[model samples]
Target chain A: MTDRTPGTRSSSGYSAWRLIAEELRAEIGDGRLRAGDRLPTEAALAERFSVNRHTARQATATLAEDGLVESRRGSGTYVTGEAMRLHRIGVRTRLTKSLGEKASASGNLRVLNSAVEDAPTDIARRLALDGGKAVRIETTRSAGGQQISMSTHWFDVSRLPDIATVLRRTGSVTSALRESGVDDYVRTSTVVGARHATASEVAVLDLGQGAIVLVTEGLDSLTDGTPLQHVVTRFAAQRVRLDIEHPRAD
Target chain B: MTDRTPGTRSSSGYSAWRLIAEELRAEIGDGRLRAGDRLPTEAALAERFSVNRHTARQATATLAEDGLVESRRGSGTYVTGEAMRLHRIGVRTRLTKSLGEKASASGNLRVLNSAVEDAPTDIARRLALDGGKAVRIETTRSAGGQQISMSTHWFDVSRLPDIATVLRRTGSVTSALRESGVDDYVRTSTVVGARHATASEVAVLDLGQGAIVLVTEGLDSLTDGTPLQHVVTRFAAQRVRLDIEHPRAD
Candidate 1:
């Protein structure tokens, strides 16, 4: 073990603890320390870094404050798993996934089922579609060979002249609707809920029984109050966590 | 087959759809339907409720809007599961049982470990304690027969006189701290992260290997800038979903 003596202040006059924290952070960034990996105890860490126990503890505390590690009772501090990127739900500009990047991530789409069906009565009213004129697009998406999410989107057929042809070729309802000359749409509202997965959902998402699924239904409307899309998406509960950050109005 | 006759209402009215939605909502509240139970399809439900396919669809949509059920495309609608109650991270509300019955839902504290060792260099500075004058209380808590979480709370030994006697009798760090004449404390900051469960955490919380754990560290300070308590809590990820709501100030 190295001597447990506080290091001399460097040329920059930085404290021993700050320097140690910076080194450990660099190691984590370089993929040396990974999620669930435990660092040495205070004594061992002090010896390893050639610092007193107090200085070593200070470095670790700094890491904890920055959300890099978690210290449990009786359990040594371990690296955090995945960090979630939080975004405000209502902001539209931040929603884009960079079309080029998203295309490269996964270009394959599974057309689960589609039909020229009448809008469900409630959807008809919400979309203001004629009594029996709506087209539905149901699709499932996968990423990295794992099922990511499933969505069913509804659009008024009257609004799209060639809805079927567009859906068949593009495989994206958003793109299909946009191609149909509809623009300037706003997501009016979204309702969220959680539920146990059905047998088919479990099979499609490869989830175990009793695993919860979060569902979000979003309604988009044109500038003239014409409903453009009523889309519902179901996400695998275990693999994803939804964060809705509301913007603060100053 | 249910008739496809279009209802004569051009605008809004107490449509047949609203009546059916009320019945389904009542069934859920009365426990006839439960989380994870599947509902019959539009065809079957229309036949049973004596309504058109459109009306049946409308009823289901209303439930979906209310966050009561989730409808997966090509599959079916199922009851939404109830997850954990959302709590703002820095909000200092007294933790209480779900049922509102304190005695039955109260948590039991198990003092896993305790020590009066020298403060780790970092902790000493944070707590403003001398190297040899800090006490750490490591505790695990169980609620409703389940190990809900574990916490490590540190205190300055000088401020807390006869800590062992108070801890042994009160069985609560918050209560003991209050009894020792400390007041006007506020949570200064909190750090949160997620990770896979450790072997001991899995055993204690009865969690699976892949289950996620949500860890939060909270620091509290008195009005005079004296550190009051430092607590770290780990919550079972599957059983709880963290919800944080902040008012948007535009």
Candidate 2:
């Protein structure tokens, strides 16, 4: 039943399944397993690991749980293209990376609108600012010259000392934040939902009447847990997909 | 320090933190705590639960881990809308419900393309069919009036009798399979990925050039583990967010 030669194992007392999963995970991480590659069957895997069918199945399930493999009912299991790509660090990172990857692949981002305004009540509360003290940055992002999303990110002016100067000079909020010395931060929370696009969103995104919108609001904080930013992004439903990678607990 | 009346429990059996979390969870499940509703400060929760500040924070952390609440650095935790609305289930249930929900959300199916062509080598192997014998159905779906997603589902004609008649009459593939007397079935496996949309997918989805596509491919099987179907769905990136809720084994 062995379809591939069993690799030499290290001295540690790891289970056959763990060893096999590590091998496959290494391959995926190292870029050897491309998106469309087909993996060996369970029987073959069992033989290679010198284990029973149950152990082989468990190993395969581990990979599947990690979003690494796809199995068809009558068809065999195969590697998915999505599993080959590296996910961004946090929710916002995921969003920005997804957009950047797609945009870089076939298009470019265009700044449709850029403005500074008073933070909305929700944003104000999220940023922990007095009602009128929070500053909001609004930008409409486009790909291939077509608008895809509108983002409004709020920052507490008390924390961000020179917002207007940074906005006028750099244009990228992330870059500005980093330049301002708050480089180490993690996404504290993300809330996502879907609804019909508003008239302005429809006009800007060029969406049809029936098109929906996916909304994501997130908060980011420093390591010591100081809330740094709050951002809300709305995407034209027809144009994008949001993927979240969930690692299984051991 | 009590901000509001304590819940049914005034127990010292469980830790005060545990009691507080249970109360909040019950509130969320019962819809008393709606999405976007902010919780009271740590001091307030501490007073209500008769717990120390650290214990109250720990309770909030538990809620955050379950994706039931969002905690900003300085701002208090708030209920997440999606967390309240969507139930994260296993991969099998996700695939089944996704199709059902998509169809329900999008009122009609528009046959973007269909053919009785030879399956690609990868697809043929996936369906366990001779390369040329697999029948493919390609459909684009729309909600209200605008396009939302595209799907390509395949079946081996040799295994599925009267495929054309079933497709023509039932409209729903799951229903078609049910009518064919294939009552006992389960999703054997699923693969998921995110990527830049292809030119064809972009056109079919009406997505902007930079929009990401979330793709899910799976196999459904009979109780005896006989493969029944292979299906692939491409969702417009901005329209949907994939959530996988894994149970912790602690």
Candidate 3:
């Protein structure tokens, strides 16, 4: 039993199952156990660790509960790894382009509110507009039929006079911009931050209060460097990971 | 007085102070009120908003508690604007190079533990080590006299023997690598994620139990593209924003 046992325990005591789970978790983290790999049977794990069947079952259960594994009714448990989709943000990030096939196929946008409002002073500066007011569009974006982000966009109203109407028809800012005669845009800057979701975010994104929201404040401009849009997007942190690329540095 | 009031109150009904705070928060978020901008005086804000001084004070107090503003002795309140430092991660992210002058001058690393241990399977693969064992170093880093991050690093011992000794003398992994005859390396990939601080992270980083930690799991390779290191660093999400740049994308 001693020879078969793996992992060293420190003097500070942990439960038998917990130690087993930690060792396995490290294996998963390190890459010994990969996604879709079947875990050993309870009896085999018990025998290898010199623990009882109950402990082995508990260890696998812990891993499953943590979303590291899945147990089918007939088939044995298998590693799931992260299981979350990777969203890449590059110099030219398009929501449709960055998302995976399933997300891209099912991605939908709902305009919660759209109006020509007094542009916040900063938004005015970013959009390079003279007036205090600009067009504001609040939207909830869903992917794979689940709400993923709440985005508030500010645009210079005079430049895109019928943006709200165009956005309503297109259900996409990029498409609306294209209709407005702006063919292409690139991300100029992005400030990435995180904060607890506000009550409205909790409701809009269907997340718990205090859930982490990955906040991206970004500016996008025309290919000619004419600023076009300033957007603030709050993403459900658990559901998405923002991959930001800094192209100029390389 | 009520005629001067701004912002539409939701059905849930917020206090005058909260409405004021929200508007100010939006302004700050949009970049109207930038860092070091002195806020309007309490009397001025109360007059402009048609609210009492107490309400204005409450708004500023709320912002202060949220780390958006700071009150100095005899000096007016100013927008601190997030207060947290931005730590940029890129193809060649060096802690000293990424941090600002204050952080760079004061930043320190404390070795929590160093040992030759079974590399987590994923880390083993990242380092291209055939053997299961690797050198592990756990550390806590601080700047401006506050704990900032807890990092766990794995290195293939065969490639860089006595790394711990070199790290101890240099207090920097990059320097230790240089000492080991590896002149330079670059980040290959980074996985950015966030989760509630673990117990050990909370204790080591001096954070509340449920505080968020921004995690980056990454691998570094030599200029010639030989994998050299796998590191997992967790930053106090409230205190630092990881600015990732995709150098190759540009």
Among the numbered candidates, top DockQ falls to 3
lDDT of 2 by residue, B1-250 (tens): 2323333332211234544664575456434677899987888887776667787787687677556689877777898764422323232443335544534632365544556767767778867786558778787765534455678878887777565567556555656777887765665555454444543565577753223455656676666766677877666644454444322212
- Model 1, residue A92: displacement in angstroms? 15
Cα deviation at B210, candidate 3, in Å, is 1.9
Q: Sort all candidates by lDDT, best to worst.
A: 3, 1, 2
Candidate 1 lDDT over residue span B23-52, tens digit each? 565456323587888988989878776667
Q: State the DockQ, from 0 to 1, for candidate 2.
A: 0.03
TM-score of 2: 0.38
What CAPRI-style quality would you assign to candidate 3?
Answer: incorrect
lDDT per prediction? 0.59, 0.58, 0.72
- Cα lDDT of model 1 by residue, A1-250, tens digit: 1113324454322356655665565345323677789977989878777778897898788677556688988999998764222212342312324222333332544566667778767788888886858878777765445455677878787777577677667765556667888745666665444444443566677654233355556677775656778877666644444444333221
Query: Which runs of model 3 end up more than 4 angstroms from their true locations?
Result: A1-83, A105-107, A246-250, B1-82, B105-107, B246-250
Which of the numbered candidates is closest to the native, going by highest TM-score? Answer: 3
- Chain A TM-score values, per prediction: 0.60, 0.56, 0.69
Candidate 2, residues A1-250, lDDT tens digits: the string is 2213233332222245544664564455333565678878989888776778787776677677556688878787788765332223242363345665554532333334444567666567777777557666666666544466777767777788676467546556666777888776767665554544443565577654223456666677776667788877776644454454333211
Model 3 Cα shift for residue A209 (angstroms): 2.8
Better-scoring candidate (lDDT), 1 or 3: 3
Give lDDT tens digits, candidate 3, residues B1-250: 3224643333222456665665576556545678999999999989888778998998798778657799988999998845577787777887866666766632377778899988866677778888757999988888776677889888888888788888877778788899999888888777776665544565688764245677778888887778888888888877787765633222
Which is the leading candidate under lDDT?
3
Name the candidate, 2 or 3, with the larger DockQ value: 3
